[model samples]
Target chain A: MECTDFKLIVVGGSAGSFSVVSHLLAGLRPDFKLPIVLSLHRLKHVRSGLVEGLSLKSKLRVIEPNDKEKLQQNTVYLAPANYHLFVELDGTVALSTEESHNHSRPSIDHTLGSAAYAYRDKLLGILLTGANRDGAAGMKEIADNKGFTIVQDPLSCDIDTMPKEALKLFRPDRLMNPEDILHFLNALPG
Target chain B: MQNSEKDYNYKEYLLILKECSPYDFSEYSDNSIDRRIKKIMRDQGLNMEELVLKTRTEPDFVEQVVEAITVNTTELFRDPDVWNHILKKVLPALKHQKKINIWHAGCSTGQEVYSLLILLDHLQILDRAEIYATDISKKALEQAKKGQYFYNFNAEKYRENFKASFEGETVPDFDSYFSADADKDLLKIRTDFSEKVQFIKHDLVKGDLPFYNKFDLIFCRNVLIYFQGSLQSKIVERFHENLFPGGTMILGSHESLGGFFKTKFSKNGPVYHRTNSFHFKY
Candidate 1:
């Protein structure tokens, strides 16, 4: 699918993804129109205002979505700390406390797989630096759904296990450092 | 190429499940169920066909599959602020009643049940409350009934949640609730709390709501997210019918009412109250 045809942009990471996410957000045009979801792993059983913390650095409007909240353009949705976030067929958010996948809640695999199923080929999935293999299977799901996939270059990742796993599992459309990812986000059709 | 084949196998597995049993997975969203089946396959070291054969022949295999699919992890006072809100705002409104009936519909492992008991104990009304804690997983229900959990249960985080839940109030000694087991890494809930809770095995998706008496409060948290929108709405309607007029229903922090029931829920505590007279569907 063309970049303009994409309905949503999803990014998944764990451990060391904050810097890249913040940088990507900082580089986005204020008028960016595609909805973006951040499925970064977080400490469960503790209330952390990750969305609020990241909003300080992001130019785009960022919020933790309520269950069944509709998708909107030019906004960032952070998966809540303890729940698994899913994109529903109706383009709304659904959160589950179902058994954690890969030993992590807010699991990257759940988020990416559900988004792939929801948006089909009109989705772009980006996997970033992390120490676990959570996103590998989800990346494959996105590829299977004919969506575009990108991975942070393992050579440049601070913790390369996550991206390396994604790369090993399937071929992503792009493998670039944080700098190129930021540039790519800025260059997308608004 | 390989991933698409896996997807096909997942569908076949779901079909086999439906054909062999009274349950229907056709209404569920495929991705979540797909991942769960994959995990089952990996953990059992069996491909889809072998798994299907086991289910067809084995008497208890289907329950195990359902358990794996629906099981959710929970701990005491998770999202403590919400529990605190229930204590301060929700409980007081029902104070006029001489006895209170509470239902924790998806009470996996009974953390919430014990938490509620603790709160009631603090309020000195523990004797008057009867809680029915239910889950689809018999294994989880067995654990909840035992009231024993790993000693590794994050005391620091529990303390933090307690402080946040109580805000300015003096927090109870969180550790005092559980008696340490002789084994290094286990703790059992004090008998006082465990005695008041009743854990039952029940399925929310395909099974019927078996309660004869309407409840004063119902908690169905973090459970509906696995179902499709249609199933979620259907279950919420059933909950609405099962509740006494003005009885409160608490969903997970992230959960909300979908379909026509959207306007039925009032928003102060994000707790839905049934306003109309109740009627049983059957």
Candidate 2:
């Protein structure tokens, strides 16, 4: 599917998904103007390292935002460990320590739900391979709100539980492999 | 253009909230507050005009609004290891003191305060402990003071959390804390457990701490992560000044002291010890 006109891109993943994320980030143009927010499941106790890890491979600037930091174009923002990240109606970031939903902080459901509310049809939501079902309901929310939604092809995932769960919840606008998603993001108007 | 419109709506709503309630949310992180307000609006199916009008005209409507915006999520024996650390290393050091002054800042619904109290009671030190629990949300403080919770306490989660608190120690009976109410819809902690706790309504972000020069231990968990970086540092400084020399402060598992306060306290997982006397550096 060829798509554009999105203001924000949200990506959620868990176990065995980092390599796909890294590959996708490496392929995106350095000047890609849409703000991309990532909500990868992380160890709740440790801080740091993850952003640095992603930044090493990403062409775009990678950052972990402080509470209330404004979303900026061409930057990749990762949710900090142990805090649930949210998007505000005015397009800034909010962090919450509310009880872990689906047994994970930075749960995909919370982030995507907020983004779906804030950006509506202007959001592109992507769910990748994960061991848990955290992103299923969130992807559903995005699709329900008229935002474009995509899931990594379950047959190709190292772990299919997450994408399979999303498939069970709602039909996504596109089902892709890592390379297709990379090209899709790169093809968006800069 | 869309962003500007949302920004205008957000600021106006916050102004309405400030005028209608005792708390000022203006200084709290803006995006967090805005998202929460939007969540409330979405849940209630109300537009900004409806929300503002209801907030102005409806009595106790503002309370529900405040509760919705404020982060009150907590659990019994949260991060049990922190409690274990306090019980093992911190409390014995204060055992000889004739009086213990403890403050649980942003003590949402009072679970951490009561957890500490239960530990003190187990150690047979409750008689000398003076506990102060404070939160910015009056609704939360009211629930805390009432100590009655609908939706029965989860004994299994409680047991699991307690088991994780200590290494190889026999688990305490979690059932002892809660008894069913007449309707069987709620589980209320025995009133005697909270008899010594003094619940106060205080804002940690915009206002001065309610007390000065008296706390031996302070528990301000999960609350700091909600704030912006500067506010976190400021509140940590206030915590330092409030704590007695050699006293201990416990932050949430995810939070830590920033800047120079990092030097003022020695850290142990989630616990920090005030080293020597502190002088607030302007």
Candidate 3:
């Protein structure tokens, strides 16, 4: 698919993701137009105010996704605290609790893999700082469907496990620091 | 019935795993498979033969089963000591390579790529490096390309690890990396360094290698543990083919190339080099 047609961008992380996310957004421009989603693995009991916290660093509006929320360009959506977020065929968000995959409810795999299937070539998958391999298979699904893939350099990550795991499993298109990733996204034709 | 006489049904599960998914549980350690299978049975409420029968009749069930069995839990630089090792040993050794090609296979979301980029940027080699990051999941890839992460969730851990990695040195202020918007929804990466890297879609299981057997350095860390011995062996063979002569390969700290290949290369910490003749074990 044409690069401009790539409307969906998903970012997955768990532990140590905040700084990576902060660094990435610090480099991005306000005019960025893709629909960015954050799927962070969290404890069921923990209150995930990620959308509110990250809004401080980003130019786009950030909010926790609501049921059947229609995805829009230049907006950032966070997967709700306890549900897996998916991209519907009509370019809207769908939430589910249909059992956890890889021991995660708001699993990076479920959200990302499902989005890959729905968005196909118009998707971009990003795996950031996390402690587990939650996003690895989802990253693979993105590539299989001909979507762009990027991984934070594990060496620079606060917790290298997730990025390191991904580096070992799939061949991503780029390996960059958060700064570089921010720069790249800001430069996108959006 | 005797202990041995009880129906293990090993062959049936093996056939199912081989035919249905890319995983081959047959050659895996029996204890690991047994534990995983037990968990699968317990979770799905199925016995061994029943699970096999369900798989045969329901193709979608196989996807759930594969998801259950794979060891997908990971973090960014799960093992920081390994990164320390690379920083102290591997990067210094490769200082001479003018233009570097680094492949971070299975880069779920761009965390590890950012980590490596930070290292390269510090070492003054990032400009000369071309990092090829790939994965099988497009969702993860999309996240990786965007490079935006959750600030409040990861800041503390990032600071702690950053201190450990730098040993109290003044590191980059991560907060300065992103800008907050009016609605607090969108985050974008700055353009300065983002232009250097390229994000693409690639599947190692079924797709062709991009560099065509000429990567200068490859990082294939903890991913092989999910594959059975045969598939792991095949992937290692592919890695061997993808690397240039005397190129480097980095694996996870817990993982080793034991019995997978016969090669003579100096183990520089977690990184392995291809010295003389590189053979494809498969």
What's the true lDDT of residue A7 in model 2? 94
Residue B77 error, candidate 3, Å: 3.1
Pairs of residues clashing in candidate 1: none
Tens-digit lDDT track of model 3 for A55-122 = 88777788776545679877888887656677766776755433466778688987888788778788
Candidate 2 vs candidate 3, lDDT winner: 2
Question: Each candidate: how many clashes?
Answer: 0, 0, 109
Worst 10 residues of 2 chain B by lDDT: B150-159
TM-score of chain B of each: 0.90, 0.88, 0.71
Give one digit per residue, the lDDT tens place, for model 2 in A24-96. Answer: 8888888889999999997544445888889889999998886667899999999887689988777888778
Please tell me which predicted candidate would have the highest DockQ against the true structure.
1
Once fitted onto the true fold, the runs of candidate 3 whose alpha carbons sit more than 4 angstroms away are: A1-190, B1-7, B20-28, B40-54, B57-61, B92-98, B136-153, B168-170, B176-211, B226-234, B259-263, B277-282
Interface RMSD of each: 2.0, 3.8, 15.9
Q: Is the docking of candidate 1 incorrect, acceptable, medium or high quality?
A: medium
TM-score of each: 0.87, 0.73, 0.49
